[model samples]
Target: MSPPRVETVLIVDDSLVQRLHMVGLLRQCGIHGILEAVDGNQALELLSALDTLPHLIVVDLEMPGMDGVEFILQMMKRNVMAPLVISSNRDLSLICSVENMAQALEIPILAAWKKPLTKQHLAEILHHSPDRPPPSHSTPETHKEASSTGAHELALAISRHQLLPYYQPQIDLKSGTITGVEVLARWPHAEKGFIPPDHFIPLAEKHRLIHDLTLEIAGQAFAQAAHWRRSGVHLTVAVNLSPRLLDLPDFVSEIDALLQQYQLPAEQVIWEVTESSLAADLGIALANLARLRLKGFGLSIDDYGTGFSSMQQLSRIPFTELKIDRSFVHRAHQREHLRVILQSALDMAHKMSLVTVAEGIETLEDWKLLREFGCNLAQGYFIAKPMPGETFTGWVKTQNTRRHGRRGS
Candidate 1:
């Protein structure tokens, strides 16, 4: 009744410590018949020697010879079809197409682990594997709802222009005045009401639709930001960039054209790079980020502290903002050690001249704690949930009017 488990994992890495630690953890997590390879060559030989195939492979990005990426390429040459979870210090597998980069090499990346691994990171990798699927319904509407929140129903929503930017205001600690808004995409299905990004983003990625979705979201966000700039608000609006678009040869040029088309100043539109997405190809990713920065776009490191984006990478990656990942912020108030961690992160970001933003704030205590740490910008449900551009504009106007009346009275 153990669900007829059919999972065998091969872990390849050069570090003896990593190998032992990972193997022990996999055993703790219910992994079966684990195999070890120190480098790509050994891993290749192991597969060649075996008649039965490994159900899964976990690889470190770095090894003495024929690194993890090279191993994946070779696996493609042999047409190995298995689920893979890459463990690496470099974080490159998450952003780059590990499965698609090598011709005809297909591996399902359950997840990528950033180095000096945490139990949480390991759990996440196991949970995200292709072997596991989050609970779902069997209805077609659910699938359609997930696909685009009725955005896919072009006939109904295309004319309606249903795609909208929902802004979550980020506050400045010194003054409670809203310093900026992080633009998040929202799709309202006629039947479903509000469909979350998690529901559809994976589908979009699977269908290679995120590239276009990113552009559409940017266009909408830029227009709203431009409107605010015109009204003397001059607030920075950050939009998440889809990883698929990052590698596109013309990503930089495309963004430039969109900025011009919307008449949005590049400085006002902050481009968010998620940690997992950029870990895959630092060179290519950083190169594109540099191009964006040179063109006047503000670069922000999204989900900071969630991956292996070292301080060195931040200093060299041309980022203008460091968003403390919610994991650290959520526990900062309850735990003393966590407070030190959060404070250190804040201190480090400020030292680097990167504006620090706290994400996933849920409680007033958490918000106050972040503010106490000299963390300036923040976003979370405690502040305001993401809503349409119109809703955000109205919220801003109302806040300003209330302040004006309070002062006059």
Candidate 2:
């Protein structure tokens, strides 16, 4: 088979030797059009002068001036969407931090590899498809999608009950059984197909529609769970809780009433919230969370490591689960730095007697690695993307068949 076809790449490093080495590897990978820059400033200048963005960018974290982190921030500001690879000999921790920073800025980072770039690493990064959708060029459709979404439009959608709930299955890593699912809110726009939550969620919050949206999503999830219980599935259902809803005077009571209305058990539902969410109205949110927990509902500290005071939150709240963010979990098998962080997180959760879940298990290697590390549950694109509530029963059957076949083999 032929090597993957990458037409152009830009190599950013202060070291002349490193740039030359990268160019050699690009040629080896059948990538001929190579652009080199001595530092981040030079790279920006090159980018400004070019008519098109390169297919990939490989940069060193440590540079003489305008380092990789600043370069990425600048790239975000300039709306450069090229895929990124961090090639740094610096400490893996620093490289990992930079990778996280870039991801937070919405830059598509492919991988972070230790310095002294190797042909194999370059091949892996270049040939591997990123988990995220590739950045779109300025096509008319892309431009149309990028156009501003009005908060009023979202408020109208909520009022019309147009928002839908999609379920992402979570698996028991060791047993290969379907533990439950995380419910995600999806908008089925008449004209736009399915508008991503990232597009409308902020609008919901900004327009004071988050409370209604959350309730709509939770009601659907609860009713579905009750339906499944009657059908003998007995799977736990989880819903993302907006921080804005926690401060409501009736938040806990309203949620409990919904559970009773659907006839779903509190223990069978999980409320997933970020650590930062609890900070919005600390006293009220904590009281509400405590009340929910006392009533036997599961509480998860979602995206465990990304928040400002994760440890503090974990210690203070009566959380039942800890979800390691995708950034640390997805590439843990390949990046030692990430593995270190993942291991620590797993260990910490175990010591706290909280069930540990690793999200974003995309590759088989990472899945196997997390299972070996004894993660209680797993979820991501590897198992399945979020699907409609009505189709989850069939998905469970397919998963059972695959599990049985593996056992037989």
Candidate 3:
């Protein structure tokens, strides 16, 4: 009455001798089916041609034409997910982390290793990953597989604290004035032109890289705001809080420390949480929201109507601002009832004494409709898309300058 054995695994490297050694180890470990690839391309080809992708991939950093990094980048684009181990004879250099680059691309990696794959090493990876291959599509994708030297170069950028924040404006309808700005993240990897949040944010989350990334964005935003303060421009900065970060009980306390460290007013900071977040732990969410609000921080529901708990979410959480999701606003005119939906949302918010903000005002018609319907504020392409913090500050100054110019004229 012995248990059934596990399936085979694929080992990708340019060296045949190393592959054979790995095959021997797998056999000893009771993994009978062993597939081999001399390099990333062949490995990928074999993986695609197979009825089922291999149970695991053991990648080598240095390979022929399409190296391990290039292979990983391609793997990310295709969404070919599998637990990966970076096995190389050399040390874990800045470059080897590229295998973990999938985290940034939302591909997950199990572990990286030095050459001469050992049984104990296999045991360690298997202990945690006995049932399923680690979800490679999780955050902080293997860095070793991103681009030529991209693994090392990207590491340098992050370690050197070069990641920066850009800002998108949120308007105020009551005074017809520029209000706060949402702090959007930006990293100009020398090789990867304007790395999108879709590419990096999730990776940061998957690998727990979000901790550092979040701190960096918070610090940078505060510094940018302090600079504008000297120039007489003060704007509230809103940063999106992911469910991963919010789940931690200390999340609010951490923000408290950040505010004190940066000498920024709690009133000057706004935190945006999605509807999905409100549902995760309703009790925790309400308690944290109340704590943040008590400390003078602003809280808003982002993409409000999209989540399943719209009614319950609003009722349970006392959010200061209700954001009408862009999806509803975009189709409001067509569905006609959608306009009614927007009106109902507004009515509900007002009944609760919560300010309503309309997002994604892309067209003049949408703008006119929202303003006409008493939506408290409008923000989207029509107002302006997110931009660099400096650019936004300058825009604010320029607008004031123009208003002054008109008065004098």
**lDDT scores in order:** 0.74, 0.86, 0.75
Off by over 4 Å in 2: 2-5, 14-17, 27-30, 62-70, 127-147, 334-340
Candidate 1 RMSD to the correct structure: 12.3
Candidate 1 error regions (>4 Å): 1-160, 406-409
Would you give me the overall lDDT of model 3?
0.75
Candidate 2 weakest lDDT stretch, 10 residues:
131-140
Regions of candidate 3 where Cα sits further than 4 Å from its true position: 1-156, 278-285, 406-409
- Model with the higher lDDT, candidate 1 or 2: 2
Model 3, 1-409: lDDT tens digits are: 1322336678888998998888888787778888888998898888777766666788888898788888888887776877677787665543334743755675556666767879877775655454754343433454433423333454466678777888877777655577778788888766656666665777677766676678778888988887776777788788887777766788789889988877888989878888888546767767788889999988888888878888877776657888888867863553465688888888888888887889877666777777778888878877777888767877887877887888799
- Evaluate model 1: give its lDDT: 0.74
The residue pairs found clashing in candidate 1 are 91-279, 91-280, 92-279, 92-280, 93-280
Q: Where does the lowest 10-residue lDDT sum fall in candidate 3?
A: 143-152
1-409: candidate 2 lDDT, tens digit per residue: 3756567788999998888889898888888889989899999999888777787889888898898888988888878788989989888778888887887787888888888879987876866745443453323356465246677888888878788889999999888899899999999888878787887888788878899899988998898889999988899898888899888879999999999999888999999988799767789989999999998899999998887899889888999999999988887887787788899999999998999888888878889999988899999988999999878789888878988999899
